[model samples]
Target: MSDWLHNLPVPMMALVIFGFTYFLAALVFVAVALAATEERAKSLKAISPGMLPVLGIIFGLFVAFTAAQVWGDSDRAGAAVSREASALRSAVLLAAGLPAEQETKLRGLVRDYVGQAVAEEWPMMAHQEASLKATPPALADALKLVVTMMPQGRAQETSQREIVAALEQALDARRQRIIVSLASVNSVKWWCLYLQALCELLVIGFVHCDNRLGSAIAMGLFATGVATSVLLIAAHDRPFTGQISISPEPLRQIMPEAPTGHS
Candidate 1:
């Protein structure tokens, strides 16, 4: 229920969040107004000094902090995807420097790896699941296969070394990306965000106990703003699941197609 709210399109998210929060705020206001009437016989104060402004400041800072953290996580996830693709491209270039037999074999492995990652593994990540179990990169086997072909001379040996290094880097990048796909913000932080939002509304409830309709309007506006920010943060909570997600464009660009015979 909450996730659906978070990932909704911006206008829908704002409307839904405002609707729910406004209802709750109105309910709180009614209760507070009754209490204020009862207490007025003894004391005529609506609320304590400076509570609303203080709570507003606190809410704003919390939103800013959470947004920054989630933004950083999303950026890191995207960079991991790019790095993995770059390493794979490097491996392909170095593989070309090998003998014809080794070159074909290595290129085939690279091609299969790219194709699988783009078509199969990427969809799983979008769903916040681990990558597909079938057709695992078999990266180790590929490395060992290349190592089996002893280089003909110093130049070949150097090229093989660079290819091995690049593949290893690609493997590391893929590992990072998989870990990132499974990542999420902590539950405690979410609790704090919601708690503060409620607190801000509660402050409004108490301060506006004398005017229900005016309070409701104020809360509607406030709720619209807060809920939009909260949903924006929530939309970014899962780096791979929302509007601002990492794409597999890099991998797709390198996917091997059939050989052409134009000549």
Candidate 2:
């Protein structure tokens, strides 16, 4: 089912699903309204046709809000990844301040970590799991050595403090990247999409009752609108999947020689 849904030309699929569902809903609503009118013919029933316009306005607003949220989420994910890559690069450069051997080891660790994320974590992001692990023990060990090398004077204390600060920043960046990547899936957005879909169906149904030709046109319009919205939301929601997904280009550029392993 998932594959089938994913395989459809997104725009067309969205239209077909929304149009059929809404048309059915309109039929049911018209039937009920007609039944009620028949039951109270002597009471002079007056239907408020204005409600349709109001519904359309509400639907438009809801769709706009969802689109904004999806776009925001996509932007945030991209920014977070970029920030992480920058932090990693900065950390690698700072490692040069350490003793020669320690610097080489730290740089290697950073390269390995970036490589693992690109090769492993990236591919599995769509699946919501990261299997490859590039341990930070090597980096930690280098930091420990740097701290020990500090002399008993004020300069040593100051240098040690700087090293600690850089390490902390790198670790924080790494944590942020992981958290943001994991949170790429916005379930609440999905629910909102579902509600918007329901409302769209209701609107289509209302049109169906007023005029058959008009209803068909409305269905076409509604289908196209809803499908476009869903496609936009899905593209952003799974920012790591599909052709429009965010690329790990920054990581690639940073660790050119790093091993490509799962995570």
Candidate 3:
């Protein structure tokens, strides 16, 4: 069920979340209607006049802040991906300065690394897992192979050094990408959101029982609005999954031979 939910497109997920939230709110309304006495409802309604606006404002701000944080994290994850791809391109260009024989070897190594990255590493990003084939030792082996040959000239030597540095930079960026991919909003925060939403809905259900149609309409809208925020956060939460995932296009273009991978 979770996988099915996660696989849904952003809009679909938003709709699903909205429907579920509204249904839950409806249940709350029914429960309150069953449980409330006239006297209790009147008292709660009296307090509701003073409380609803304040609670709405606080919860709205909290949800907005949480959404902002997730969006920021997703943005950083995308930037890290671009930076990693750029460094890879730099390493490729630097390889051009080597002798023909050495250049072939270095380029092949780079190609394999890139191939494995797109082929094996990229798919793992959706789940925030590192690809074993694209691990440091595997990439380092490819790099070590490039530096093993003596440089043909001063220019070649300089280029080799640059290639090494660029590869290192790429690795650093890759690490950052991995870290960002793995990061997510805390579960505790999500639980708190649910708790707050439930409380607010319960209050609304109790205070508005006299006008079922009006309360249902308002409850549906409010629940959908809050769920939309949550859905937006969920969509961006991974930055490497769902409809808004970071594309592997940059890596594909940079990779020589351009191996088709599971995107």
Candidate 4:
């Protein structure tokens, strides 16, 4: 699936997939039907219908394998965002254990990080342009501030340790999300899926070549299934790129009032 198709709205996406699939099916029906002579029709009818079930099974497996990766990426992307948000919230709470001035500064740093993530990093991730080379400055500063501060008491010492841990977790979660954002169904798998589907379509044409009406009906129904399966999988193939993408709302929820520049 191309980025242009994935980026389309759901209804438009469906129309394109369904329309293209039906067109291909019609072409197959016409080619087979017109080419079938009386003697050839007898041979075509003799072609085992049993092969149809086998081809259908193979096509189903292709869809299953492809869909598994797509759905898994979506699930992982969601989990990573949620974990990052949870870690940031924990750090904010732990910041309270510091002195008023230090705690305020620490909270401010967290806000800045979240704000930048929502405004800048998100768009980059959407296009798979985000890189690990770009370490978030705010998080780096917060880590520095927390690690350098001398704990005045047991409570402060605990807060310092926990806040550091929280920040680390947040960083890890961010890394996970960015890595998952880069995941997509590779071209080889896509080719395999389509080729298998084409094989099935050809088998439908072969087995029903003697009867144009039966051929048309079988191809239409199968094409619809193939198109719908493909549309559903392709829409989510690149978890971060599509209209069904994971949003930065989890990060935004951390500091709704934080000043954000451009998304």
Candidate 5:
């Protein structure tokens, strides 16, 4: 769940998860096989195969529950970014209603804000370091200008009010994305998930203790399933931190010709 692991490309991430699961399966098999004496085999055989289905069900439930949260976070992150871009686009269009000088300044402000978001805020979001403790300065200045600017007619007056509304929408969208960026699977849930998996692996070993070949094959298949489930969840767990994260292209499109370097 570390950033290093999440940032790996999909194929490499799959390899790591599969390899770890296989190794753990092998370890459990070796331990159980070593202790499988003739009398122990009899007792081990008594461990009902019915428990296999029961344990498997419990493990599946854990994976399903965890996956739901991860998928939700990803969806929310994408929506927030899209909504922010749309609001900024509205502001840029509405600026045309103002005097030529004021319109130019408002457009420049939007450009500055998008550039900062791409070059500065993005990396911070990826690392879960973007905080809402301070307002974005470019957006703040735009809001102040819209509120205080003198309008000569109904057209400019309506534009000013709508621009303020658009800026507020963009601000709310920014807050949503930052909050979603901070989301991740907590340690307690991870601990529970792994512990459940280990229990299932142990049960498999007990059920097939007398036959090493059978034990290995069954565990290997189950391990593959476990690995696949884990990989799917982990790849999308931290929406902004991973290779498959939501992009800033929507924001960049608002001011396509502007440079994206931090000032």
Candidate 6:
């Protein structure tokens, strides 16, 4: 069910589901209002003057909530990319302290990792892969060797410990980047919020139907509002998929060449 929902084309899905829901709600509202009018036509000859203001307040609150969620998700996705890039850059600089051959090998692995993340992992994340195959076994081996090659003395050991710490930090950052990328998809809350928006639109339509604002004005407002919300949600959910996504330029710029000696 989740996969089916995610695979839906954005505009069509929003229109079909939200539109149908709003239609049902509007029908119900109209039916109830008609029944009330017939039952008390003589005694209660007036529509509630407070209905518009009440609906407006409710709609405003709903819009604000949706906006806040979208904004929060957008910021998180952007921060994740920045944090991952900073960690990768620091790891690359730290690799310079290793022996020349080790340095070369480690840098190569880092470069490959970045490239694979940009080119391959971004796509796989949409399918909900926890992490990418960026750090191969060879890279892990090189990291282990860096730990083993520390000189035997308190001062040198301390420096080695710092290097190890940095390496660990880098690995953690990489994992976090992958996790955030995969997890940024809209949560169940998003669906519920969308449903609420549709309900609000239906209520709006029923309340204003007597004003005779014409179908175009009514639909235009509802469609525009709903589409904007969905687009914002989808963009944040798959930050790396669309044109507005966080670019891989930072990683690409720092990509190192493959080292010699590895077959």
TM-score of each: 0.86, 0.70, 0.89, 0.94, 0.96, 0.69
lDDT against the true structure, per candidate, is: 0.76, 0.59, 0.76, 0.88, 0.91, 0.59
56-137: candidate 2 lDDT, tens digit per residue: 6776777687777657766776876777677666666665565666556666776766666677767666454542255356
* Per-residue accuracy of model 3 over 1-263 as CA lDDT, tens digit each: 24456668977988898887887887888887777677777765665445677778878887887888888878888888788789888877877787776666666677777777677676777766764344665468757866686877899889988988888888888888777777777778777787788878877776787778877877787787778878877777777777888887887788755334786
lDDT of 2: 0.59
**Which pairs clash in model 5?**
none
Off by over 4 Å in 1: 1-16, 38-44, 131-135, 260-263
Which candidate's TM-score is highest? 5
Ranking according to TM-score, highest score first: 5, 4, 3, 1, 2, 6
Ranking by lDDT: 5, 4, 3, 1, 2, 6
lDDT (10s digit) by residue, model 6, range 79-156: 766666676666667666556766676677777677767777666655566455556454465468667785556645
Error of 2 at 189 (Å): 5.2
TM-score comparison, 4 vs 5, better candidate: 5
Global CA lDDT computed for model 5: 0.91
How far residue 143's Cα lies from its native spot in candidate 1, in Å, is: 1.5
Residue pairs with colliding backbones in model 2 are: 26-205, 120-262, 120-263, 132-262
| Candidate 6 colliding pairs, count | 0
RMSD of 1: 2.9
lDDT of 4: 0.88
lDDT at 68 for candidate 5? 97
lDDT by residue (tens digit), candidate 4, 1-263? 66678779989999998998888888888888876788777877777889988989988998998899999999999999999999999999888799988888888899999989988888888778889987899999999999999999999999999999999999999999999988998899878877887778878888878667888898899999999998899888877886888998888888625434877
RMSD of each: 2.9, 5.9, 4.1, 3.4, 3.0, 5.0
Task: Give the distance in Å from residue 199's predicted Cα in candidate 3 to where it truly belongs.
Answer: 1.8
